[model samples]
Target chain A: MGSGLLVETYVFVLAVFVGFQLISKVPSVLHTPLMSATNAIHGIVLVAALTLAASVRTPGGIWVAAGAVFLATLNVVGGFVVTDRILGMFRSTKRSE
Target chain B: MNTVIQLLYLLTAVFFMLGVMRLRSPATARSGNQLAALGMAIALAATLWANHRFAGGALIALAALLGLVVGSAAALKVRMTAMPQMVALFNGMGGGAAALVAAGDWVARGPGGAAGAIAALFTVLVGSVSFSGSLIAFLKLQEWIQGRPIVYPGQKAVSLLLLLVDLAAGVALAAGNLGQGPTPMGLYSLLALLLGIQVVLPIGGADMPVVISLLNAMTGLAAAASGFLLQNQVLIIAGALVGASGTILTQQMSRAMNRPLSNILFGAFGQLRTEGGQAVEGTVQSATVEDVATLLAYARRVIIVPGYGLAVARAQQEVRQLMDKLLQRNVDVRFAIHPVAGRMPGHMNVLLAEADVPYDRLYEMEVINPEFAQTDVALVIGANDVTNPAARTQPSSPLYGMPILNVDQAAHIVVLKRSMNPGFAGVDNPLYLNPKTQMLFGDAKASLTQLLKALDEV
Candidate 1:
């Protein structure tokens, strides 16, 4: 709710919009790699949520922060775990008839 | 404290931009991934430093360690052939996470926090639905579930009623009407479960790619809603990008199949067939490996077209070997790849790549379609629907107006299929009856190996 926080939020929003615009122009061939990298950003969110939960003083802010941290952590870890399991389905071994 | 976090946010944004830029080519994709990863790390570190949360350090570390082990195993073990399934599962996880975030917020704050409560409820609803829908898609693609559409009496009525109930719940939650009563979390979760089942139940095999794209878009929207609840600008922007792109991809896929989006959702074209309805009338010609090998050995130019059948049979290596043998005989061999080939986009290319097929030899549908006329032999390895000429010539066919490989234009066509069954679109192919086309019925790998031996005799 502070002015400094407002400015930070604005700058962050602008940067993200710019980032989206840049990626929109990328061709299809590069999508996989791009996605893999963006996926890691979930980790950053997890850390931020945890830190905020521990330090923030507002009533119930800790719970909010904790919940955010948990979700972000799940996004980061669960994404890759599921991806690997799905990938295993494609392994084709020769079946003798 | 704010200044440092702000700087970290800006840095994360820049890395995201650079990552997107690097995605323009496969050659730089790895570097792009690294850049995004670095950006995420910076943002996380800065946020943590600003808040200085240390109570759960040990727990977080343990979780991180487990993640690293599981992630590495998946990355190292997953085959390229199953990339779509992998994508679906990841999308589901992302959506599930977003939904859980919303659910957690709602349960903790109750209805007094109206704005947060509503946002959380909406995200949970959408995210959960997307998550379950995507999981079904994964099963369908993996063949763990039937590829054919499932329909029962009054299915449409049930789906419509479910949608109505889901909407009503959303409206009630948004109005902040449950302050003194028990939360409708149970109802909302049930609606989400039904929505998932309803959406995926009617989708047939041929429409899996389109369904995947649509679910992907839903997940993105759910993420954006969760971001709104958290008031995170970066999450909103990224989520919006994904949602928009996914929607566009779904549209394109629908257009490519020459079907309207509504047709895909409600018509359920491939789910059932009229009893005893026979395929379109056409002459059937059969061939042996020696016959196919003789044609290939004597031909100066050959074009190989692959489909889902090839992937199902795991025949990429044999096909590659056949190409190698043809190359030894000084034959000109090129692969004709359809844009919507196999079960998903780029499916054939990935399978072929695993077999170490030369990249230069693979040609997209647009580029190679015209050359089919000049080709001496169009060797279709386990492909059916995409190569069907009926799409181009038949106006009433379900697949009419769709783009297809011009293999029928070639001098001679050899089609390898397991049976005379129709493709996923549930339409008989006239190409199968063409005079120039010869059907070599069997498993793709087995047929290719047989043909290889017969070629040796020739």
Candidate 2:
């Protein structure tokens, strides 16, 4: 692998580790907020995956990059959908007398 | 190529941190969401830029457009009321995607890479289970399926057997034995499916908040497993965050319900009607809207405590209306929202917000619980279990230690309910017998409407 590619890979992996570590320290009460934030990170990962896939020449590299893109996209979109749905359970309505 | 990608990664991390920081308050949550979305868009664009494969840019652009259209439509179309189901569906999708990835990886590897094979196996099992389990939970919440527990003889043993089979399949897959591999994998998935079904089937409507928390945790575990399979640190980290948060929330919820986690998991507490259950021995006092209206109109202070019953009846708007009327009369009105008032966390808050109730008027269980003592009247609408005095007074009761609204401390308590049926925890509320408490038996919405009408007259 080229030095540039190697450096990018390290940064990506390091970012993931650091992000998780920092988020792990978040208090339990702040989960919804933390989740909302991490969800954005997942989006970034998705974009990065696509970019890596595009630039990589090797077949294996292309496949892995594509896979990363899919997984990361799923994480971001899925998180929001789930969070919104969970929030909906609390909507109160008037009862029939 | 790498410099650009690295810059994108750095930007993504910054946005992620910003979003996480913004989540500390509800006021900034929307902004946080937008920031995260922006970060994700940047990341996607960067990835597309990096790709050198066949028309990678076109495919990325196409995917982005498709995603934007579909996502925007869902965001615009889905009402806040249907959010929980949406969350479940999305969680299922995440799990499903992870499982598919594992499957694809396995197929690509030709079943020879032992480590990859094991990781794939774990990911698929966890992901599939979470996917199916979350779907069932969504169904239960949506009332697409019954929320009541479905139990027959030997149900626990059956669940145990299913779990055992799942474990056995994991062992076989890890051992690189494909001879009977597919069978066990299929069986493991089936058992996980049943586990989801059986686990949720017995829980009552009241337990949905906890169920959501539990399911959220499951989804996290699934994601983390998928991360391991893909050797992706970020996935693992994100998944762990979700899993741990969900677990903690579940514990807090369980505590709020005054039940041990074991009882919640294995006791099937809400499923069966206790045998020899007799009608609660109490002198039930009844009231009319006129009487309630009179009391509220003259009262120096009134506290409203809402519960799942309120949500079920969709009485939040009427409740808000009632509050407005009471406020106009110079009655000091405030809401006493229990921590576990609705099916999920912040359920009551969300419901009240929809009614355009001011954020200031709403008080958490801890804040309002103490104020109930000095309050002249505690108006409980369609709330049963959370306000039950049994949680505080009855040691033998299932909800004995659970924190309640303390509505019983008020000089006068008004409870509106459809019937005297026991709550989800299957315990009778002794608060109904309190001389100061009066039962207004009817649909909560209708009762509130009548009360509002009577208030107008008063």
Candidate with maximal DockQ = 1
The candidate 1 chain B region of ten consecutive residues with least summed lDDT is B177-186
Instruction: Provide the TM-score for each candidate, comma-separated.
Output: 0.85, 0.82
TM-score, structure 2 vs. true: 0.82
What candidate 1 gets wrong by more than 4 Å, as runs, is A1-97, B50-67, B110-118, B180-183, B275-279
lDDT of 1 at B13: 64
Where does model 2 exceed 4 Å of error?
A1-97, B2-7, B50-72, B110-118, B179-191, B276-280
Q: TM-score of the second chain in each model?
A: 0.92, 0.90
Model 2, B240-342: lDDT tens digits are 5556556666777787777777677667666646752333576989998899999999999999888778878888889988988998899999988776776
- Give the 10-residue window scoring lowest on summed lDDT in candidate 1 chain A: A88-97
Docking verdict class for candidate 1: incorrect
lDDT of 2 by residue, A1-97 (tens): 4453344346445544554555455443334434433432333334334434455444543454455445446556655554443333322223211
What docking grade does candidate 2 earn? incorrect
DockQ of predicted candidate 2: 0.16
lDDT of 2 at B57: 49
Top-lDDT candidate index: 1
